[model samples]
Target: METKEENFPNDSTMESIKSLTEKDAKTFLNLIYALIKDNENPSEQLISNVLTIFEKQLPRVAKARQNKN
Candidate 1:
């Protein structure tokens, strides 16, 4: 029997995550934890803040990758 692979919509986001430095990754994780810790359903503003954080990191990630080349 053959198995099929499933693709995630956020695969690119996952790839970007791999490029984060250890400290930044930890900060991101901590922020996510803090945002969701008390709320069963996170607010839209909270979600927006999370996206803003990730978007801010993308520039740094891209710069680091460029420097590596």
Candidate 2:
């Protein structure tokens, strides 16, 4: 399997990760854990659910960053 470094060809992704707040980082980790919890590939429904969550979160994240600026 390709490692994360191999998956991301540039350092910008790592830099963005470093900028994440602790809570945001934990939320991402939790999402990853949830996806891999069963030690098997996540089901399509679960992927759909996660994508829905991201869809809901993106605006909130953008709003929060806008507020910070």
Candidate 3:
């Protein structure tokens, strides 16, 4: 019996959600949860990896999306 309070991610989570695509963000969040389910140390290597990919594509995506406006 989980409460509504336990179902929502906090502000930082929202920000991360905003930073990623809906599909990718959901996948990422699930992966993070799985990693933590083991109760082991969480290294942000996957995050850094994703950010590297995003940062590389950032300029192009921004330009393309901006042009659509």
Could you say which candidate leads in TM-score?
1
Tens-place lDDT per residue, model 1, 1-69, is 423432222555666777777886787788778877765555867766666666666556746765997
Residues 1-69 of candidate 3 have per-residue lDDT tens digits of 869875455554454445555666566556656655654444566545444444444444445544766
Candidate 2 residues lying further than 4 Å off, grouped into runs, are: 1-5, 38-67
**Could you say which candidate leads in lDDT?**
1
Clashing pairs in 3: none
Q: What's the true lDDT of residue 23 in model 3? A: 63
Query: Model 3 — which ten-residue stretch has the worst lDDT?
Result: 50-59
What would the C-alpha RMSD of candidate 3 be, to one decimal place? 9.1
Residue-by-residue lDDT tens digits, candidate 2, 1-69: 758655332454444455567887788769767776854545766766655545455446545755797
Q: For model 2, where is the 10-residue window of minimal lDDT?
A: 7-16
Error of 1 at 61 (Å): 4.4
* lDDT of every model, 2 decimals: 0.66, 0.59, 0.52
Report, for all candidates in order, the number of backbone clashes.
Answer: 0, 0, 0
Candidate 2: C-alpha lDDT: 0.59
Model 3 stretches with alpha carbons more than 4 Å out? 1-17, 42-69
Better of 1 and 2 by TM-score: 1
Error of 3 at 57 (Å): 13
